[model samples]
Each structure stands twice: as structure tokens, then as C-alpha cells.
Target: MAEVYQRLAEHLDRLPDGFAPSEDGAEIRLLKRLFTPEEAELAVHLTLDREEVGAIAARASLPEEEAKERLEEMAGKGLIFSAETEGGKVLYQAAPFVIGIYEFQVNRLSDGFLQDLNDYWSTVKERKEPKTINQLRTIPINESIDSRLEVLPYENVYALVEAHDRFAVAPCICRSRAKKLGKGCDAPIDTCLVFGDFADYYVRTGKGRHISKEEAKELLVKADEANLVLNPTNSMLVSAICCCCGCCCGILKSLKYASKPSEAVASSFIVEYDEPKCVGCLKCVERCQMEAVTADVGGVRLDKDRCIGCGLCVSTCPTGALNLVRKPDRGEKLPETFFDTWRAIAKQRDAA
Candidate 1:
């Protein structure tokens, strides 16, 4: 039975987002925590490609009815992915552990499960996924960017939510995991925003509640005031946005140690320090979650490679010494749609 889960972990690692094996097989232990022996065996037979139950059963040599029942159960448990076509045909696919199954387990996650995950993550010394293929990107606070710059509608957080009719609010899975571990911060937990079909999934699965567009805007403001990083899905049409804290967010915490963190981020802008207006108050240094600001000979200095251009520092600058500068290195272009974003990611991950 343990060996079955070991194989399951290896199988999951081959997926696009990846689930690398940790030292001493901590990754396998985490898998065992999430799946039963039967479920583990069933999962190893699945692929990232979506397929009907009948087709999957044929491939696995299981009865169609049995396969359907098991697949539905796994989907409900957030161990697999399922989608309904417009004509009502249901399809199931293998889901990646982090941004997929682990996140979907919001409603069903237990303290024990979180502890196992924390243990597994702590044992892993290196990043599991490559930096260039991140699923999320940091964006500036809505009003922090200079109005003169040609900020695209998708670059603005407020416009992004207003463009979507469906909105849902869910607990921050990372914060929730921290809370269960008894080391959670005072930051708000229910700050994760989802949209369109992703919003519908959360609401339908009891993982989150439907929210109005107005309420979504209000949450973004509150999150900004709390110094949370606005990390939206890396897509022109974002499916979700996360209000992240450096202390709790897995992505930010990992990037803190990287020598070239900016290369990992998909930010459109970078923080610029105005030496002429600087007062050396060090407010921006204290406000930076990425540790990108520092008190130097000339008031403060911006670590161009460390800053993710989140604009949190700009909001706390009393003398207006900080501003978000559009990165000339980037062409100020984004994918036209979410499909394009996935296509680009697939190429990077070599899954295309």
C-alpha cells in the first residue's frame, strides 16, 4: 500500500506544475496523508489529459460504473479534477498537487494534513518548480501606479474584477494552513478572490461564497492597507487573486532567499526610489514585504532585482519618495486570454 502511494507521488511529479520528491520521501508521506490506498492506486492510472469515465475505465480495465463512482468521489475530495461540458458531458483529469488538488482541499483540509504538508515543504531545500513558469504574478495596488502611464485594464486590479460577473471569496489556503498550525498572522484569512467558472467551482464545492463586484473591490482595498501582496493568476483574464503575506505566502517566502528574485516574477513594473524627495524616514524599508527597500547613503535604495513591483511600499511613503516604474525590459504586453497564458506555460513546462 505504501509503495502504491510512492508510485502515485512519482506520477504526480511528472505533471506540468510538478510535485518533486522530498528527501527521506516526505513527498510520498504527504501523498499518503491525502489519499487512501484505493484512491492512490486509482490516481496512478489517471493522466493530465481529460477523459470520460468510460474511456478511463477502458484504459484502466475497471468496470465503467465503478470507475465513474470512484472518479466522482476523488473529485469531491479534491484529489482529481472534473469539469462539465456545455452539453453536460463530464470529464475527469489528473490535478497537480499545489495549485490544483491541495488548493481545492480548502473545505476538507485537516490539521494533520497541513502538518504533513509543512513537514514536507520544510524538508525540501530547493524550489519544486522553475521560476519562469509561475502560475501567479505580482501586480501593483490599484491607485499606486502613475496615472500618466498607459496601464492596461488587466494590469489594474479593480478593472479586472469589474470585468467579471461572477465573483467568490475564499479563505487564504496558506493562512488557513498556518492557523491550523497555531502560527498564523493577524492578516485577514478570507481574502482569496475567484472569478467566472473558478468562482462557480468554489461556491458549488462549499469552498467559498459568492461575492458582489463592489465587495471584491472593497476587499482589495482592505488587503492593500494590510500590506498584503496582490498576486493575481498569470493570465490576461485572471481566474483568481490572492492577498498574500510574506510571512505566510509560500511563493514570497521562497523568493526572499533567491539572489535573482525578479527573474522569477512576471511583474510589469519595478519600484523606483526618488533620491531628491527622499527623507530617509525608512518607512518604505519597513513596509516592503520582499525586503527590496533599504536605508542607504541616499535616503533609500531599491533592489531592482528583488522588487516585485507590488506597490505596497509606495503607499507607505510619506514624502512620495517611492513610485512604481514600468519596466522597459518588458514590452508591456500580456496574454490576450487565459488560454494563451496556459499555452505559454505549457511550452515552458515542456508539457505542450
Candidate 2:
């Protein structure tokens, strides 16, 4: 075990400074509880790719069988993903929460850069604000995309059109058991789409891409025409990539990471739960992977202002017992600049 920890520390040291180890006091306790010293060491050495496993094992001086066995234990505890690959290969990736160091980056960046990028974002947001699941006048997800609408619905689930970056057009491909699932966990979101002043910088510098806000809106309109249920303002607020859940959406690879909160929902819809309507069928409780929902005397209780408005609870309510309502009061439902996405470029220039 000491050898494992020593080698693991060496592996951690080799990772780029950006990769944060899971060391929160609480997370530390959880890791201690969930993984053995060897497994924990292996967790520190893992990445999303399968090809890196052998190198990590060689670095640790452990036999491939030993490293592989330790990882399997972590997967059982949901600490890492060591799912099987069809070609007799083992696919290893960090579990979502363990992988959330990336989200922490976004959350951190949003705080400082959000204002600097606001002028351009403010306009892009206008087109996205009041993003409704059901637009008043729109197309349906069933018949759009020509006749490619098979068991899966849109280009998102359909492999051909999904890109990690819309403008840069990076192939954010997820592999399947047959074609090979991208991301491995099968998240419906091939990648989260981002649009802002910096997003354009991403494209030009190969840092990211400059996808016009209007063009994004057009994509949504096309999605609407296809009858795909699109989240309003979500592209602007949380991510540009529209996640397709299998149970919830045809994409976001819902089936892959449904059990893990970190890999599953990027942002949750915070809402209020009317216990009177909840029958304690645990429908909402069951659907809420976040454990944000709890049982009250009446039935289920919701923590408002914290919900990401996923509407999953409502969708699961056989009796419509749960509802994910809009939070206009908390987050300022309007951006105060609707229909100005076209001019976002000018805003960024002035900021620069």
C-alpha cells in the first residue's frame, strides 16, 4: 500500500497543474471510505482514455493485472469508470464528481471573466433568455432531420452532426458498443457548447471558436423544427451543447451516467416542491439523483434557488405530482437585452 501511494503521488506530480486532485476534507473522507489504498492510488493515476492505463501501471511498477483489479474495485464504488471495451480492452475514466475539477474551472472562470465577457454575452443571452422547453410556435423533434430520425431523435444522438465546438467544429464524438461511445459513459452531451466573447477567441486561436449567437439560435430553431425539446437560455447560461438523454433525452448519453450526479446533469433546475401534490411515490425523490429532494410530512420537499430546473421530477410524476417551475425572481428571468445577439461582436470589441 505504501508503494502504491508513493507511485500514485509520482503520477499525480506528473499531471498538469490544472488537474486538481480530489482532496476536499469531505471528499477525502469519502475516498478513504470508498477505496482501498491501492485503489485510491490508481484513482490518482487515471484519465478518460484506455491507452494510458499501461503507462500508468508501468510507472507504478505494478503488474497490469494488479492495477486493473484495483480500478475495478473503484468502479464498483463509483470512484472511477472502468467499463468494458468490446475489443477485449478495458476503458478507464474518472467518475463525474472526481472529474468535476473541470467544472470547478468553469465555475471559477464564470465569476471573474463573466463580467468582462458580459457585453458580448449580454447580447447572446438575449436570444437565450426565457429558454422554454416548449416554445409557443415551433417544430417537433419527431420529423425534422430528414428521415434520419431512427430510435434516436436528432443529430445529437445521431453521431453525424454532433461537434464538441459548433464553430471550431471539433468532433466531440462519443463511441457506442457498436460504433464506439464517445466519453465512454455515454453522456448525451458530446460536449457542452459555449458562446461568449472568449468563445470566439477559442475558435480563432484554436482555444475555442466563435459561433454567432444568432447561429446558435438558428440551430435551436432547427431543433424545434425537429420536435426536439430544447432548454431556453441554457446554451447561454450553463452550456452551449444540448445534452440528449436516453430516458430524458436521446443524447446527453443519459443511460451512461444516470447514477452519477456529477457526470449526469451539468446544471440542475432548482425548484419548489408542493408536498400537497407529492404522494411520496418517491417519483420526484427517485428522479432526483442529487438527493436535493427529501421527504416531509406531506410528502416530498424541494429546495428552491438551488434547483437547476431539470424538470425530471415533473416528467417522472405519473400523477404530475412534481413540477419544475421557472425561477424568474431569483436569477432575473430576463437579461434586459433580448434580440441583441447579432451585435454581441461589437460589445466584445468595445470591451477589448
Candidate 3:
């Protein structure tokens, strides 16, 4: 196995556009456990809808039976499978970590990338300052799905803007991601919230504005040149933005510098903790991306000032120890903004 791995390593004299093939990293470690070196190598080579036997022949020059057998063996290991709808054909892909490793160069970052990005975060993005949804103007971010999600901002010092979009359907790709401790990331922006349909997002709901399809394409090109990855799913262009905590959506596990939500992203809302019913199980603390909870030999503590008021930590509590309270000054109640925007846009877009 080591010999095969070494042999392949020598072949990768250079990486693809901003991409590294595979090696011993968190992602590669995951793939290595799931596949043999030969299979893994082939896994990277197979195109999305390409045939399994042809892909192996192209990469390994193996005979049909051998390649087919190997592909089936991998299928047994869940390494390969036949597509049901798109192609009803055998195709192979690298394992999760292998794909993640493939994403790493673009998703995660190295040390030098992090330093340069941090510089951009503080100087250019200005994410640490509190923000208002009415004033936010940039790309138009929209989502199709209404389940839990997070939209990380790019202007804050942290370079990760934790947000969620509440829409449920999408016509493009599946998901977007944030800068995971690396290069080519948007400067983290202060977190903000979006609600209603697309209208309120540009007005009172969130920081970003709706983008034209052409503009959205331009943004993707811009991110490409900077080596940044947007929602591969492109849901942002289809849905509204949300502020969420770690206990719920996938992003905003933590703010980069502050243990709690930054002053900028903190909700115009707050979460109150009832110590009398609190069991001190550390669940809230674990789920609070804001780190608003603390203990000092007494019981769990909720720092009202630190809570962004996404109300996530409260949802998971066992003893009914928490609840979310709206902050009157935090953001605007823009239901009219939503109706006006959606109506106007629908009128214009549909009329056209």
C-alpha cells in the first residue's frame, strides 16, 4: 500500500488549478481508511458522470475484468456506486475526506494565507462594528431551502460570518461555505439577519442585496480569482440570510476573536437564562457559539450582552432553562419591506 501511494505521489509533479491531489491530511486520512491507494487514485480521476471501467483504464491501464472487479469491490466498501437517475451507470468517487481534502486547498488554509486574510479582515471588511440590515448592500444572497443553515459574513475580523438562510428550494447547486481558517477568504463581516422573501434581505432583513444572475456569475468569477469558494450550491443567490448559533445550523461554530458574538453580529435580540431551572449540564455552553454561558462554582451563566439571540441554545435545553427575547433596537421589523420587494420584483421579473 505504501509503495502504491509513493508511486502515485511521484506522479503528482504539480497540482491542478488551486487544487492538491491527495496525501496524508485530515481529508486524505479519511479516504485512505476507506479505499486502497489504487482505488483512491482512480477515485480522484473519475469524472462526475464518467464510467467506472473507462476511468480506471485511463488512470491505471488495467484490463476490463480487473477494473470492473475492483470497482465492484469498492462499491462493496461504499467507495463506488452506480448512479440511479442521472446515468444509471457505474461511477466512482473518492471518499468524504478525500473530497474534503480536495476541498481543503480551497476550503481550509495554510498559515501564510491565514495571516494575510486576517489583515484583510480587520482593515478592509470592518466586520467588528455593529451593522444595520437597511444599510447593507453588496451581492443579492438568496436561498431555496427553509431548514437550518448558517451564512458566514466576510467582513468581520474573524473572516467567518455565521448566518443561516431560511429558504427551502434551489435550482442551482446545494450549499455554500465560509473561510475555514485559510486564504482567499472574504474579510469576515459583522453578522446580520435576513427574513421574509428576497425583498426584506436587501432592506431590513440582512446585509446583502439581491444580485442579478449576471452579477452572481461575476461574483463567482471574483471568488475564483481570489481562490475563494462560494456556496457550491449557490443557495445564497436564491434565499435570504440568517444569524444562527452552533447548536443549530452548520456554520458559526465560533467567532474568530471573541468568545461571544461580536458586537457587530450580536442580535438586536437576546436570550435569557433561568438559573433556577438550569441543570448545568454544559449543553447550552456547548451549543452557544457566542460563548455567552459561563460557570463560577455556582451555576450556568448567560451573558445577555453576549447573546446574538438566534435562540438556538434555548431550543435544545432540557429543563426549559432558556428563551429568546427580541431586542427592540437590534434590527428592523420589515414585513412591508418584504412584501414590497417581492411584489415589485415579481411584477418586474414576471412581466419581463
Candidate 4:
């Protein structure tokens, strides 16, 4: 049984966003926590690409009815992915451990499960193939950008949400896990917002509730006011938005330890401070989740590399000294649609 899960872990490691193997066998244990022996065997045959049950069963060499039942059951448990198409055909697929299956377990995650996941995460530092597409990217607070710079629809949180008719909110899984480990902060827990097909998956799987577009915009404002980092999907179509904090978000916390944190995720802007207007009040320093701001000899200095262009510091500046400028090199190119972005990443993985 244990060997089955070990095989399952190895299978997951081959996906686009890999589940790298661990020396301590923690990966296998994490798999066991999420999958039964039979489930592990079945899951090993699945792929990250979505397919109808007949196709999935053909790949697994099982009857369509039998595979459909098991796959639907796994989807119900938040262990696999399932979705209904425009034509009403059901599709099943495997999902990565993080940013996928683990996130889907928002409503039902156990403390023990989180501990095992954290342990597994701690061990997975090195990998053979780096991801071509960042799982998340920083989006500036819509209201905090400099009035002069032209903000794109994708860069504005409210504009992105307005494009989606269906919306859903789930607990911030990182904060939930941190709370379980007694390392969490008072930052709001239920601020993860999803849209379109992603939103449908969350609500259909019973992990989240449907929310109005107005409610979604309000949540974005509330999160910005709370000094949370706004991270959305790395695509322009904006399938999801995560209200993150430095204290609990895996992405933000990891940036603190990264040798070159700026390269860890994509950002369209960087902070620029006006020295003459600076008061050294240190409000920006307090609000900056990236540790990019600090008191300098004359005023506050901004670490352009450390700043992810979240605009939280701009909102906190009483002196009106800080503003976000478009990062010309990286900001110029963005995928026009979510699927276009995903396909680009998939192509890189295939080439590798």
C-alpha cells in the first residue's frame, strides 16, 4: 500500500508544475493522507490535461462506468479535478498537490494533513525542471498606482473581476495552514477569489460559495485596506485573485528568504519614491509585505528588487511620495487570455 503511494508521488512529479521527490519519503506520506491505495493506483494513471471519462478509462485500461464512478468520487473528495463542458460532457483530470488539490480542500482540510503537507513542502527545494509559468503574479492595488501611468484592465483588480460573471471566495489555504501550526496572523482568512471555470470548480466541489461581482470588488478593497498583497493568476484573463499577507502567504514568506526575490514571480510595476516629499513616517515600511521599504538617512529607501509592485506601500504613504511605475521590460508582454498563458507554459514543459 505504501509502495502504491510512492508510485503515485513519482507520477505527480512528472506533471508540468512538478511534485518533486523527497529524501525522507514525506511525499509518499502526503499522498497517503490524500489517497487510498486504490485511489493512488487510479490517480497515477490520470493526467493534468482534462479528458472525458471514456478517454480517461482508456488510458487506465478500465471500463468507462467504473472509472467515471471513481473519478467523480475523487472529485467530490477534492482529490482530483472534474468539470462539465458547454456540451455537458464531464471531464476528469489530475491536479498538482499545491495550488490545485490542496487548495481545493479549503473547507475540509485537517490539521494533520497540513502538517504533513508543510513537511513535504520543506523538503522540496530543488528540482530538475523549473516552471516556465509562475503560478502567481503580483497585481498593483488599483487605486494606489500613480495617476499619470495608464493602468491596463488586467492590472486593475476591479476591472478584472468585472469581466467575470461568476465569482467565488475560499479561505486562504496558506493562512489556514499557518493558523493550524500556531504561526498565523490576524489577517483575513477567507479572501481567495476565483472566477470563470476555476470559480465553477470551487463551488461545484463544495469548497467555496458563489459571490456577486460587486461583493468580489468589495473584498478586493477590504484586502487592500488590510495591507494584504494582491496576487492574481499570471494571465491577463485573470481566473483567480489571492489576498495574501507577508505573515502567512507561502509566496510572500518565501520571498523573504529568496536570494533574488524579484525573479520568483512576475510583476508589471516597481515602486518609485520622491525624496523631497518623504517624511520618514515609516508607514510604507510597516505596510510593505516584501520588506522593500526601510528608513534611510534622509527618508525611506525602497529596494526596487524586493518590491513586487503590490502598491500596498503607496496606500500607506502619508507624504504622497511613493508611486508605481511600469516595469518596461517585463510588463510589455502579457498573454491576452488565460488559456493562451496556460498553453504557453505547457509548450515550455513539453520542450523541456
Give per-model TM-scores: 0.90, 0.30, 0.33, 0.93
User: Model 4: clashing residue pairs?
Assistant: none
Candidate 2, residue 59: Cα displacement in angstroms equals: 2.5
- Candidate 4, residues 276-306, lDDT tens digits: the string is 9998888898899888888889788877878
Per-candidate Cα lDDT values, in order, are 0.82, 0.38, 0.38, 0.81
lDDT of each residue in 113-194, candidate 3, tens digit only: 4444334323432223222322111221222111243323321111211333232211110112333332122322222222
Off by over 4 Å in 3: 1-119, 122-131, 134-238, 242-263, 266-268, 329-352
Q: Write the per-residue lDDT of candidate 1 for residues 239-334, one digit (tens) a residue.
A: 889999998888788778778777778788888877899988887887788889888986887888999889999988888888888886655356
* Candidate 2 structure quality by residue, lDDT tens digits, 1-352: 5555444434432332211233332323333344578676667766534444677688667898888777655554445444344465656654333122222122123323323222322332122122222111111222222243232212232221232234322122222221232123333322333433223323432323455445554554443333234332222222234432233332333323345432233332234555556667775665553455767776876654334444445555666555443233333232212112212322332343
Using alpha carbons, what is the TM-score of model 3?
A: 0.33
What number of clashing residue pairs does each candidate have, in the order they appear? Answer: 0, 39, 40, 0
Over 4 Å off, model 4: 128-132, 331-333, 336-343
RMSD of every candidate to native, in Å, equals: 2.6, 18.0, 17.8, 2.0
Highest TM-score: which candidate?
A: 4
